[model samples]
Target: MNSLYHGSELCEVDADGNVAVPAFLEDAFAPETSPEIVVAKHQADDCLIGYGRAHLSTLAERAERRRVAEEERGEEARSHYRRMRGTFGLSERIKRDGRGLRIPPAMRHLGRIDDLALFVGAGDSFEIWNPQLALESDDEHFRALAEFRLRMRGTKTAGVH
Candidate 1:
């Protein structure tokens, strides 16, 4: 079976730009191989999506099927190239070290991430969001979750005991 990701965790990002992969999501990584994750921009949102290295093959296969279908319809190659560029060209594969994955600068900019990253799992993949920005998300579920996280973070930071 494929690695499935679910649940959410808020992780800290260091000054050097490393965000620890939430322990809950560890199952996404293969035990035998070095930990590697692919980070890409969410197609319809201002957030980043992450998945195990193995998922890349799934993406390629899907893209190939789309290409063939488009070709059968006599569609121009532009559509395929556009899809490839968006899905492959803009993505980056980063390896996790002892501390965590060093988020690439380009991805950070694309994701608008800073000191805190909210990781929300979405079955096949997970999303990394800048909590503050996520509060304005068009997705009601995401917006509500982000608000709850921010409130929880505030409570913890200001806890008396």
Candidate 2:
């Protein structure tokens, strides 16, 4: 069975932008093959999404199928190109270093992450959020979780004096 990621962990992002993958999520990664995870900006959210390499394979397969289908229609595949760019093009395959997985500068800017990242599992994938931005999320669960965790960490959310 494929790995199912569920649970949340708060991690510190060091100066080099490395954030340790939570221990609970370690089993989901196939370290023997490659110690990498794909991090991408969530299309509709102000956060980053993460998944194992296997999920990247699945995405490639789906993209290929879409490409083939577009060819069969005897029409330009602009949609396919757009989708690919939005998905694969914007993603970064980051390897795990000694400290942890390094969040590339571009992705770091895209996700607005700094100092602290709150990892929340979303079944097949997980989310990387800047705890401060998470506090503004419309999703009550995420907002509350971020709030609770920040308090536990003795960190105060901005404008929350």
Candidate 3:
């Protein structure tokens, strides 16, 4: 099972732009043979996004499936095919230098990354953000989260009394 990346960790982007992958989430990058990760721009927000090897594979598979389906459909499906294909791809491996992993330049600009960054663990993936932006986003995220929790308060789980 994959562990989710959550919570905030204070991390510094080194002089070479490398940052350490939090030990807690390292397990998600298992199957050590495949050390490469996929970093993309967050679709909904300004953040450097990280996806595990397995997750990236799954995404690629899905996109291929869409392409096949679209080919059988019509030109209308071309746009959908393009959208899916454009979304995800493999990223550079996290480099080691006795310091940390080096973030790629493309990801840096996409996430608006700076010297100070926040690594946020999301299920199956992680997000990197500028410290200030992360803080501001968290406020809005949590506010909406509270409302969502309130809406779910009465929901019952099979294991819960």
Clashing pairs in 1: none
TM-score of each: 0.87, 0.83, 0.66
Q: Mind giving the per-residue lDDT tens digits that candidate 2 earns over 38-118?
A: 899987789998887778878778899989988998868898888788788889999877537899999999999999999
Error of 3 at 65 (Å): 5.6
Better of 1 and 3 by lDDT: 1
Residue 154: error of model 3 in Å? 39
Q: Which stretches of candidate 3 lie over 4 Å from their true place?
A: 1-3, 31-33, 64-75, 78-82, 89-99, 138-161
Q: Give me the runs in candidate 2 sitting further than 4 Å from their true place.
A: 30-33, 63-79, 159-161
Output the better candidate (1/3) by TM-score: 1
List where candidate 1 sits over 4 angstroms from the true fold: 155-161
- Locate the minimum summed-lDDT window of 10 residues in model 1: 152-161
- Candidate 3 structure quality by residue, lDDT tens digits, 115-153: 756676777678777755644454777434433332344
lDDT of 3: 0.62
Model 1 C-alpha lDDT per residue in residues 38-129, reported as the tens digit of each score: 89988778899888878888989999999999999999999899878878887899998864788899999899898999998889888899
Q: Candidate 2: what lDDT?
A: 0.84
Q: Provide the clashing-pair count of each candidate structure.
A: 0, 0, 3
User: lDDT scores for all predictions?
Assistant: 0.82, 0.84, 0.62
